[model samples]
Target chain A: MTVQDIGFGTASAQPLPAQKGPVTAARQRRTWTIYAAMCVAGLLPTLLGASASLQAAGIGLWLPGAGFLSVGGWAAVLFPLTLALFVFSLVAWFWAGMVLGPVIVWLGSAALAGAMAGDTVWAGGPYAAAFATAGIGYAFHRRNVRLRDAALAKIAPRVAFLDASLAEVRAQAAEIPDPATREMTPTDLAALRYLLDRALQPVTEWGGFDIIDQFQPAALRYQLNHMGFALGIAQTAYVPNFHGYMGQAQRNLIDKYLLRKVWGYWVYESCWGHLNFTNWDPAARDNIMLTGWFGMHVGQYMLASGDRRYLEPGSLTFRLNAKTAYVHDFNTIIGSVKTNYDSAEFGLFACEPNWIYPICNHYGLASLAVQDAVTGSDNVRRYAPGWFKMLNQEFTDEAGSIIGLRSQHTGMPIPFPTGEVAYAAFQNCFAPGSAQQQWAIARREIAPAIHPDANGKMRISLPGKGLDTGNYKSGHTGSFASILVAAKEFGDAYVAEAAQNSLDSDCGLEIRDGVRRYTGGSNDTNTYAILGQLMQAGDFRRSFTQGPHAPSRTGPVLEAASYPAVLVAQAISDGDNLRLVLYPGAGEGTQTLGLERLQPGRAYTVTGATTDAVTASPDGRAGLDVMLCGRTAVTVTPA
Target chain B: MACCAFAVYLLSQLLWPLRWLRDRLLVAPAVTASASVAWSPASVAAPVARKWRWKPALLLLLAAEVFGLGVAATAASVSAPAQPSVEFLDALHGSICSAVKGSLS
Candidate 1:
C-alpha cells in the first residue's frame, strides 16, 4: 500500500499539525523576554554616553553589541564577532543546557574588550558581574534541590505505608492473562492510530512530534527510535505474522532516521561538544544515546517480524555526504556497544560527551539483550553482570534510586528525574529481577501521589511543578507516561490503571479522526503513553527477549488490505489457521483483503466473510471479501 | 585598537574551517521512495575522502596579519606626538567602526 493508503484516510497520511504546545511556547516566550531585557539594558549604556569601560561591560549584556558601536576602528570587528559569539552561545546553551559556557564566553569577551581598549576597570567589571551571576544561579539551583529534598522527606513515611499494600496488588495482577490475545478495543486501536498517523507519513515529514531542543529527548532521532519501539512491541504482541504495510511502516521510520537532517547534529556536537574534529561518525564513540537506542529499535524489528535485511553488511550506513559515510550493520552497531561497555570506566557510557545517564545505559543493556535474542549471542551475559555492578557501586544514591545523571569527567551526580520508575520497563528486558524490585520501590514511593479523583477513580498526582525533559517544558504527562510503562511491565494493574487515569484526565487526552493522543504531552511522552497502552503483563520483556510465539512465525497471513477501511486489530496465526479481527477504520463498508502463506490447492473454510469457502490459488494467495462494521472476526482454516 | 583587530582576525581564521566543514557535512541527498532501498552497500558511491586543506586559509590569514601589522606600525609612527593611551583608544575606536561597517557591507 502507498503511504497515503496505509492509514485511516488522507488526513492520517498528512503530518500532524505542528504545535509548540503550551508549555514549550511559554518557555520560548520567557527566553525571548530575557533576551529583550538584556538588549534594553545594553542600549542604556550606549544612549547615556557611558565610559568606554561601562560600554564594553554592556557588550556582555547585549547580544547585538550595541555598546561596541562607540568603540570604533578595528574594534568594530569585535561587534560582528560579539554578535556571532552571542548567537553561538545561545545555540550552545539550548542544545547542551549548560548555562556556564555561555556565561563564561559572554563575560570573557566583555573582559577582553575592556583589556584591548586599555581600560583596566572594564576588564574587572565584567568578571565581577560574571561571578555574581554564577553565584546567584548556583544558589537558585541549590534552593530548588533543597525544597525538592524536603518534599521527598515528607513523602518518605507514606512510602512504607504503600509498600505494605503492594504485595496483594501485585499478586492480583499476576492472574491477568496476556492482554495481547484479546481483540483490541476502540481505544487501543485509536492509540495505535496515533503511531500509524505519524509513521505512515513521508519520512521527510515530521508531523505529530515535538521539535524543541535537538540535543536531548526532543531530537527527531529519539522520537523516531521510540516510535519504532512502540510499533515493534505492538507487532510482537498483537500482529506478529502480518508484515504487509505494518512492516513497511517500521522500515519507513528507520529510513527517516538514516536521513542526514535527523542525525547531522551529531557532527557539530562531536566537533564542539567532544572536541573531536576528525571522526564525526555518531556510532563510533560514546553516543550510547544513538547507538544503543537505535540498536534496540532495529533488533526489535528483526525479532518481531523476522526480517534479517538489517543484518547485511553496511545495511545501516549513515551517509555523511557524497564521499563520507559511517557504514554499519546490526553486528557492527552491536560491536560499538560492546566496545563502549568494555572500555567505560563507569561501566556505562555517555549519551552526550561527558554525561552518563543510567536510563540511557538501560537502553544499551536492553539493546544487548535484544541483539542476543535476535542473533543467538551471549552479549547480555557477557556484559550485564559488570554493568549492574558498576551501576550500583557508582550510580546508585543513598535512597537506592538510580541517579538520573552523572558527570563521567567529575564523578558527580546531577539531579535528573530518572529514578526507579523510569528505569523499570527498559531494565525488565535484560534484568527482570532488578526491574521487579525497582518497580516495587517505585510503586511505594509514588504511592503517596496516587489518590482518588473527583469521580472516585485512582490517579497519580506528582508533587511540585512537573517537568517534561523531552521539550524542557513543565508538565506531568511524561511522569504519568513513565509510571504507566513501569506499572504495565511488572503487572501492577492498580498503578497502571491509576497512571492511565492521570494521563487521561490530567494530560489533555484527545481523539480525533480515530487517532488518540495526549495534547498536553510531547511527542516523546505521547509515544511512551502509546507504548504503555499497548503493553500487558510480560509483553515488554517478551517483545525484546522471546519475541513472537513460534506458531505465529509461519502461518497464513493477512498480506494486503485497504487502510482506514479494514483495520486489522488482531491478525495472528496458529501454524495453519489465520485469525483476524477487523474494524472499520473510516466507516462501516465492504472491503477486499489479500491473504498469503496459505496451503496451496486447499479449500479454506472462511467464517465471518461474504464467501463461506475459498480455494487458495496456485501461488498460495487468495482474495476474500469481508464486510466490516463493528468488531468483525474472520477465521480461515484448511477444509 | 591593533590588538583587538588582531584578536578578532585570529578568531575568525580559527573558526572558518569549522564553519566550512559544518556546511559541507550538512549537505545531504534528498531521499525519495524510488531511491530508498532496504540495504545496499553499492548505493553509497565511495569517493576518496579528502582531508581538509588548512594551508590556503592559513596563507590568506598570514597575509592579512602582515598587512594589518604594517599598517599599525605606520599609523603609530605618524601619530607618535599624541599621548599613548588617547592615541590607542582613538585608533581602536576608528578601527572597530570600520570593521563593523565592513562586516555589514
Candidate 2:
C-alpha cells in the first residue's frame, strides 16, 4: 500500500480501536493521530539500514577533510593512481556479476553471513543484500582511485639521470662473461659468496649485544640488509644458486632477524601517521627532510621475480607520496648527519633514512628498470641523493668539509659517562669528509695536519667540536680505502698497485686484508656491508687532485705512489728518478686485466683498438697514453 | 607467550654442552677470578647485589672463567675494527670487556 503501510518501523501495542458513530468521533481522531506517530517511528529500520550501505559505496574516498573540492584534489594529485584504476575495474566486475547473478542466491551467500553475525539482524533480505553489495563494491572503487593517481606522478630530475645510467648498465651486464672458464675473469660472485660465509656466523658468541645483552636476532638481520644495501646487491636473490634452497631454518632466520627489524624500523620511520619520524632512529632521520626515494627499495625486492608489481608506477608513487607526506608534516626530508654523536653506544644508529647516500643506489636501480619497462632503455641509472647538491653548497667548505654543522651546535644532547657533553644535534665522530661522492668534476687537494698517536695510530678526526653549519652531524665515520682499492684495481691496474704499495707500508700489522677497511661510521657490521657496496660504487673518491695527495705525515702511500722509474732507477740506474705512464690504450684482447711483473724503468707503449682495452710495449721507447701499469700504481709517485 | 619463548631460547644457551663446556674447559683455568668473588657481598662493599643485574649471564661468564672457557668464547668471536663484522663484534667486545672487568674488579 504505502511506504509506512509495509510496517518498516517498530510497532508499539496500544489497544485496537473500533469507531462507528458521531459519539465515537473523538476515538476516530485518536486513531488517526496514532497512525502518524507510528509512521515516523517505523522510518527507523529503513533509514538505519540504508546509511551504512551508502557509506560503504564511498570506500577509499574517506580522507582528512570532508569536501567535494578536497576529494577532487586528492583524486587529481595523489600517488598510486593505478591502484585507483584497478579498484574501479574491480568494482565494474562486481557490478556486472551482481546484475547477472540470482538476487536470492547472491544475497543468501553474502547477506546471510552478516545476518547471522547480528550486523543486520532486524533488517530484511533486500536491505541486507543492498548493504553487502555496496560495501564490497566500495572497496574496489576506492583502490582504483588511488592507483589512477599513481599513474600521473612525476619523477625527480636526479632520478631521471639515474634512469639514463640504467640503460648503459644493462648493456654492460650483457658484456660480462658468465662462466669463469676459458680466459673469462671471475666476476664478483665468488667474492660475494666468500663474504656471506664470514658474515653469517652465529651471533650467540658475539661480544656485543648481538648475542648476549637483549639480543635481537633482528639486529643481525638488519646488518645483513645493510650489507646488501651497501654492497648494492641483494645476496638473497642469488642465494639459491650459491647456497641450496632456502629451507625452513634459513627462512626462519631471515624472518626473525631481517624482516622483523625492517618492520620495527619502518614503524619508527613511518611515524604511524601520528608522531614525527624525528623521534625514531637518529642514523636515518633527516632534520629538514623532503621527498624520500630510499623507500623505493620495493623495486629491488621484486626484481628477480620480474613480477613488476613492486616496480610498478603504483608502488613507486605510493612510496614517494608516503615520503612526501611525512617530510612535509615533520621536517624537510634531508640526510640526517649534518652533525653526529655516540648513539652507537646506546645501540642506536647514527645514519638516517634520508636519501643522501644509498637511496641513490635504490633510485638508480628503479629508474633503470622503469625506463626499460616504460620507454625501453637498457641504460644503468645514476641515482643522486638530492640533499648533497643543496647541503654541500650551504654548509661545506672549499675543501667540502662541514665540521661546523655538528649535533653539539644545536644542543640535541646525548647521554654520557665520558666528560664531554653530547647533544642530539651534535654528533661525535672521529673522521671528517669520509663518504666521497663520485660526481666530483673538479679536483681539489685536501691535506689535514693529522698525527699518529703514541701507538702510531693516527685518526683523521673532523671532531664535531666546532662544526655548527649545515648538517655537520658526526654520524658515520667512513673509510673506503679498500673499496677505492677495488675500483682503482678495476679502472686502472696502476690504482690497485698503488693501493697495494700503500697497504704494504703498514708492514707487519696492517697488510692487504679483505675488501673492507676499518669503519666506525654506523653499526660496525652494517658499515662493513655498506663498505662493500661502496667498493662497487666507491662512494668516497672524487677524481684525482690537480697535484698528488700528500699525506699529512708522509705515510706509506707517498712512497708507494711514486713512479716506476723512481723505484727501479734507485735499484738499477742507481738513483735516476724517472716517471712514465703505462699505455692501456691497447685493445681489450691484449690489454691484460690480470698479469704479473710489469717491468718498471723500461720502455712501454699502448695501442688503441676497438672495445677499450690496454696493450703493453716491450720497451718504453714510444707510447700512446702510457701512464702507469701493473706494479707501478703505488710504486710511482705523483710528479 | 613471546616472553616465555624468548626466555626458553635464552635459557637454552646456558644448558647442556655449553654449561658443561663452561664448567670444564672455560671455567677451570681462571681460578684467580672465582677467588676474587669468594667473599660475601657486604665485605666487598659497593652495591654487590646491584652489580648482578643479568646475574645468570655474568654467572656463566664467571663460571666459564673458572674452567678457562670464556676466553675461548671471547677469542672465537672477536673481530678487528678494520673488517666487515666490526659492528657486530664491537658491541660484543664491549659486553665481554664489561663482563670481564666486572668480575675482575
Candidate 3:
C-alpha cells in the first residue's frame, strides 16, 4: 500500500495548479524596479569611494575574510554585488539542481567584474569565489535539508507505528526479569557458523557503481571490508576452506582496487582514481576517508592468511596518467598514510572533498593497526600519537566523543550524528583505549534507553524524542550490532547476548540454499552483525598494543590438479588424518584432485568409492579422480 | 560612475526576457496558482481587476533610461584608450542598444 493510502497525505479531486500565469506591464515594471534597485545597491560602493566593509557586512551579513576587506576603493564593489548575486543564486537553485546554478552565478559575476577590471589580474577572482561559494553552499544545504525533511516525512507514519508498538512490547517485556547470562552455547555457535557460511556463498555484488557522476564508492568499500572481516575471522573459527578462499578473495579485492591497467575504465573513473590532490588527481582527491577502509580489508587478509605477497616491492602500481604511474608496495601505501597524520593540523583525514568523517577515519586508523599487525611496520605507532592529539584538539566534542563529518577547511563539525552508538565498536578495532573511553560514555548515556522485553530482547532508543528519521536504523538494528561488537570486545557477554537476542527478534532472517540471509535488514547491517560475531577480546588489541604477529602458513590444506579452480567446500587435516569436502560451484563433471599440502607417505582408502589404494607421494602430494557432486567427502589415513 | 551603473541597468533590462522565461518555467506558475487559490473570488476581490494606469508609462520610461545608460557607457568606454574592452559587455551593449533603437525607430 502507498503512504497516501494510510492517510499520510491529502487526497483531493482538485487537479494540479495551472502551470502558467499572464504577464502584465505592471509586473514587468515591478521586476525592473527591483532589478535596478539591486544593481544600484550593488554598484554604489564599487563606482564611488564608499565603505565596502559596510556594504559587505550590511547586506552580505558577514565579511568573508580580512583579505576581502583589504580590497579597498573601486575593487571592493564586488563584495556586496557578490552577496546580492549569492542571494539571487539561492532563489535560482530552487529551480536548478547540481552545480549549474552556482557556476552560472560565478561566471556571470566574474564576467561583469571583468568589465571593471581594466588590466587588473585579480579583479574578478574574489567575486567569482564569493558567488560560487554562496550559491554552491546554499544549493548543497538545500539538498541536504530536502533529503532530511523528505526522509522524516516518508518514515514518520511507519516510525510512529513502530515506536508505539515497540513501546507496548517493551512495556510488556519489562515485567519479566532479566534472563540469566551465559557463554555462547553450541546453539549460538551453530547460528554464528550458519551466518558465516551464508556470507561465503556467492551473492549479489555490493557497493555503488557511481564513481564518475558522484564519487561515493563507500558502500562497496564498506561491504568489501566487512566481507573480508567475516571471512578472515572464519579462518580461525569453523569454516574449513575459508583460509584458502579468503586469501584468494583478499588478493582479488586488493588487486582490483590497486589501480593497475585492469578493470575496463581508467583508475580515474573510480574513487581511487582521484587519490592525490597534489598529483594528477582532481581538486577533490585529497581525502583520507577511503585509504583506511581499503587498508583494513587488505590488512585483515594479510593477518588471516599471513601472506606478505602484497607488501613485496613492485606489487601495485597507481596509474596517474599515460606514462606516469606511481608504484606502491605496502610500505609506500602505509607511508602515504603517515603523510596524512603529519600534514593534518587537526590530526583528522577528510572523508569527503572537504569534510572529515570520524567513522570512516576510524576505519583508516584501524587499517593502519592492521598493517602494523601484518607487516612489521611501525607506522601506526609513529602516526597514532599525533592523530589522537589532533583528534582530541579538533574533532572531539564537549562530551569527548569525536565529531562526525568535520570540515577540514573550516574545522567546524557538520551537523551529522557522530554518536558513540555508531562508532564505538569500529574504533575498538584500532584504538581500544579511546574506544573503551567512548564506550564508557555510551554505556552510561545510552544504556538507559536499552529496554528489555519479556523475552529479554532489548529495544534501543536514541537519546532524543521523535523519530530521528534522519537516521532511523541507528537506534534499532545498528545499535544492536554496535553494542554486540563492543560488548564482545570488552568481555561483556551479558550485553552482547542481549543485543544479539534483540537483533534475532527484530531483524528477520531466511535460509536460502542452506545459507542464512537477513530478510529484513540491509547488507551493511547484516555485515555489521558478522563483524560483531567475529570480535574477540584481543583480536585487534594484539596488533595495536603489541606489534605485528609472525605470518602463518596461508596455503590451502589441499590442492587439486585444478589449482584455485574448483571451489572447495571444506578441507582440514589433523596429524596423519585428512578430510576434504568439495563443491563443484556450478558443474557436474568428474575432476581429478591433486593433494598439494596433505601429509606425505600415507596410504588411504575411500570409505564408499571402489578405489584400490591412493598413496601420497613422498613429497606429501597425491592425485585422485572423484565425481563432483553434492557433499563429496574423501578421507585419507596413514597406513 | 553613472555610466557603469546605467550599463548594468541596461544589461538587466535586456536580460529581462531570460528572467521572465525563468520565472515562468520555475517560479511564477506555482506562485500565481497558490495566490489564485488563497484569494479566490469567493473569498477575496480580484487583484488585477483595478489596474494601475501608469504601468505602460513607467515601462516606457525605464526602457528609455536603460537605453540611454547603455549608449553612454558604450561611448565612454570606447573613448578611453587605457580601459580594456570586455567582449561580453561590448556584445551585450551592441545587441541590446541595436534591438531597443530598432524597436523605437
Model 1 DockQ class: incorrect
A1-639 in candidate 2: lDDT tens per residue?
221221111010211121112212333356446545533333343456544322222221221111111122111121122223334432332222111122222222122122112112222333433344456559967964563343223112223332343243233223321111111012232223223333333422111112211112123433333333332232221211111111222222222332222323344433522146443432244311112222222222222112234333223221122243122110111122212111211111112221122222222223233333323443222222232222223222222222122121121212111100111001101011112111110001111323344556442322333211111113222222232233231232233233333222321111012122212222333234233332322111111000011111121111121111211111101022122222221111222122112333443222221222223235312122223332222122212
Ten residues in sequence with the least summed lDDT for candidate 1 chain A: A4-13
Q: Which segments of model 3 are wrong by more than 4 Å? A: A1-214, A239-242, A259-278, A281-285, A318-326, A454-456, A461-479, A534-556, A559-595, A602-615, A623-639, B1-105
- Which number leads on lDDT? 1
Candidate 2: Cα lDDT at A388 = 26
Report the lDDT tens digits of candidate 3 across residue range A198-261.
Answer: 2333333212111211133213345445656655554433333234444555565555454432
DockQ each candidate and list the results.
Answer: 0.04, 0.01, 0.02
**Each model's TM-score?**
0.71, 0.28, 0.55
Model 3 TM-score, 2 decimals: 0.55
What fraction of the true Cα-Cα contacts (under 8 Å, chains A to B) does candidate 1 also have?
Answer: 0.03
Q: What fraction of the true interface does each of the listed models get right, in terms of native contacts kept?
A: 0.03, 0.00, 0.00
Judged by lDDT against the true structure, how good is candidate 1?
0.72
Q: Write the per-residue lDDT of candidate 1 for residues A573-594, one digit (tens) a residue.
A: 8889988898998899899999
